[model samples]
Target: MNTVMHRKPKPYRSERTTAHTSDRNASAFPSKRHARRYWILLSLFLFGGLLCSLGLLLYNNPVPVQSPSFWPVVERRITAVTTMAIAALCQSLATVAFHSVTNNRIITPSLLGFDALYSTIQTSMIFFFGAGALIGFSGTKAFLTQVGLMLVMSLLLYGWLLSGKYADLQLLLLVGIILGTGLNSLASFMRRMLDPSEFDILQARLFGSVTNADPAYFPIVIPVVLIVSVLLFLSANRLNVIALGKDVATSFGINHRRSVLYILILISLLMSMSTALIGPLTFFGFLVATLSYQVASTYDHKYVLPMAFSIGFLVLTSAYFFMYHIFNAPSVVSVIIELFGGLIFLTVLLRKRSL
Candidate 1:
């Protein structure tokens, strides 16, 4: 009997396998290194640009550096910086946390009606008490009033909706949208009734203006923003888990309802402070948070949060620099931001084919 030597069969590589291998080999190294490099470069660019914008804000004034008039200019500059910092922190942290809890990058905390609420409050004040009362209510007292009202309303709405056993995120979001719509309608009615003079006065406060921030309110805003932001930062890892969906988060030992309630409360307070401080910023937070995700290219809140803050600061400073110095139209900053942000929102929605 002639025994044939057995030959080992070589593994066959199909076209699909070859293509996949080539794709993986081509993409693997560059993808990772590119992400890392993008993070580093973005951080440097934002930080450096912030510094330059700040320098321009401080020294570009007509006041002589050696004159006694310089101190007042410097004081204004300091206040501007502080306002921008608080706005950046509040908008960045709140929006990022809001997006994580909701698990939707396209939506922002603005859905909660902070901006609409702000407009309603201002309009009501002017409608009933007149523009003089609105002006008189300015400064620290007005800031505190707005923050307190916003915080209480948020607590009432969020607590009642989220503390129950059947806490549903969709339901809560629906209620918020209804409330926002109602508030906006009321504000619109009030605006239509106002005389042109009263409307003019109300319009100034309607826009988001860093210059409108009072330094005295800084004492109140600074601590609240810092403390709440730190709390959110500490929960960053949990936020990552929450973004995975409720069932997955629960399996990981996270109490989905409780965590979401706590995060919502924090977001409310943050949005309140920012809105009370800068008036209504319809799209500032959305813009910053969206850009942060794109620039940082990571879902890890540890990286995303700081990047959001940096990007927020960079955007605010750059806009202020150009608007104040170049166009002398600082009040238009909000308009410009909202215009761009609305465009971005439409683009994102069209691309995703979902809300």
Candidate 2:
């Protein structure tokens, strides 16, 4: 009876095998087309929004539209646009590249104490030379001094913390944070000693504003931003590899240390120019970079970089338009941006459960 019905068993394929095959196919090229399409649509929308914001800023004035006041309004709008553009590029490119090199999302270029150092420079100029010196400090020489100091300081930190057989990025960041805190402390102490009027003047300088940037500085800032941005765009391929980790990057014949060093230097320069121009924007870079990653939905630097710039431009221009036109308080734009960016930072930190 047992031998009577020897039927051949069908070839066996379990549910696990089927599921794994499905997973592999699902992950191999998942959502890439959708991401590309989304980026294209988002790009068009942002560009349109930017143009509308520009129009609002330029043409939506209360003073007589056809009077001599029109020229002043036009001039102011032009300067605002120029400042916003430079700020956008600087924040976008520097933040994206900084994130790539550090491979960390929570921190920003501000960690290196560019803002704190700027505060110190201002406070010291006020504390030692009195607040009136700030007037003289607004010229081109002071701009150059600020850029030079930041460059030298960043260079020293990079060389000190990232040049050994065991280059430790954590140590560098920790030291930077510490120095920044110390510098802030000194500035605060000095601020406390200043007269009310001088302190008020220093306080004004602390707030980042498109109007605060001197037009004379734009000549230098535009060129520096353009050159650094082009360099960053060219290095996108290297940054992509670097994002994979030092070990993986080395495996691909990338000099991980050198690439990182160079990236930091370039980032320092960008931050210096931006900070020197607009004071310290602790959140704009972080906000734009985070939004860029989410909206672009891809890891490729080529796509992400331009997306970051566009988003930054859109955010800055829209903020300027709303604050200057709608709220009648442009000085608070940095505060609003920093507030939202801090909330985003907290949300991301809780969600990721890791730095």
Error of 1 at 281 (Å): 1.0
Model 1: residue 354 alpha-carbon error in angstroms: 12
Give the TM-scores of the predictions, in the order they appear: 0.86, 0.87
Q: Best TM-score goes to which candidate?
A: 2
Local accuracy by lDDT, each model: 0.83, 0.84
**Span of ten consecutive residues with least summed lDDT in model 2:** 22-31
RMSD of each: 5.3, 4.8
lDDT of 2 at 7: 55
- Model 2 TM-score is 0.87
lDDT of candidate 2 at residue 167, scale 0 to 100: 80
Per-residue alpha-carbon lDDT of candidate 1 for residues 203-288, written as tens digits (9 for 90 to 100): 99888888778889877889888999999999988998998989999999999988998999999999999999888776788888
